[model samples]
Target: MYQVSNGIGFYVLATYFLAAIESKFLRAIPYEIELIPQEEYRSKFCYSVAECRASYPRAMDRGNDFFKYLLSRVVVSSVGGIPKYNVDEDTVIRYMWDVHQAAVDVGKSQLSDVSFYSSETERDFFMDFLLAVEFSVATLYRPYINSTAEFLVGFPHRPLTDQDRNVLASDVTVREKAFMSSVKFFSRTNEATGGLFLTVWKIAMTSEAGRAAGRFLIKRLLLIPSL
Candidate 1:
């Protein structure tokens, strides 16, 4: 039998939390990160976990992008002068890797179908997964912001024009805001429809129209049980 429960709310929360993390982190960066090697910039975040880890072991091993980003900031701050917007090659590389990893993690956790049947194991897995995701998202902010600043200030040479920087910052802000808003709604309820929620978020982040449509549908769906 299909269970219509509030389990869906939990998924919403987790999704928004994830998006919040992204938004906060991106805002922290003073400049936009150009995903070096266009081929590496697949899926916003890197999708191939194995390859991502292998290629950027340092970032993966750190387990917290914020911390790494922070450390980079501390280094720059210590240097005491804002040079051109030239970030070091390694620093940029690592940043790109972290961004990719975030994308991958989100993708993996994203729900494909809303009508999920709960086997005990799957339920437990989802719970654990959400918790892990939450921890990762919450703990890394301060460090990531600090490090991002360091990287941007100490960049080896200024690669981005003022216009480019502005554009990147704007783009990141929009993305982060949209992602977190959806996640906030997702987190407040409990249901086993994570997959469905993920689909909605994906659409919302894609465009203004998609976001309006997604939110409207969600509100309508939420009213069904009451009606």
Candidate 2:
């Protein structure tokens, strides 16, 4: 019958459309992890205090010991005046999941808006979403030095030195400076993103460990400025 043929055609078209949408969604999600080798990691270190100071002059001058403490924990290497830190795979996955959830929340909120359905608007939104995801991931996992003194100084390598103790000391000045620098950096980042970064900061700050870390680095090692 004519009615049966029309129903079959509609169903086929609907199935194809769903498949296309699913493919697009999968491509939009960001889950790739690129690991750096030990040699490559060591190649990125600044090699000396002067190199670190030169790489992040302002942080050295203004960031204090807490900054150094954070630096010591994560510094895998220095790249172009910036200290790059290693992020664990689990941490990177958690960050990506958080970003993805935030995107979903935003998408859901705007679903009823006319602009949400517009092809041009949707395309722009998707592109921006992908970009934000990429920036977040890169910020978290940039390659760095894997020196024995920095990340693996004690356990797998030599014992901690006096210099290491000084660097890791829980000095009050360091903590205060770190807290202040974090506030300033996150404030600026949120302002730049028109409050987008604020949302992410809030979500991250909810965890006790995250809150402690934020109180320390404001968000993470990313708060440390280059030059």
Task: Tell me the spans in candidate 1 whose CA falls farther than 4 Å from its real position.
Answer: 1-191, 211-227
lDDT of 2 by residue, 76-190 (tens): 8898987666755545444434333433333333332433233432333333333333334333422236421221121111222243322433432443334333444545566
Number of clashes found in candidate 1: 27
After superposition on all C-alphas, the RMSD of every candidate to the true structure, in Å, is: 20.0, 24.8
Give the Å error, residue 187, model 1.
Answer: 4.2
Report the backbone clash tally of model 2. 5
Residue-by-residue lDDT tens digits, candidate 1, 34-147: 323235223323323344355434434433453345435534332446433335544554454455444444433533233242443234333433432332222221235754
lDDT of 1 at 89: 45
Q: Count the backbone clashes (under 3 Å) in each candidate.
A: 27, 5
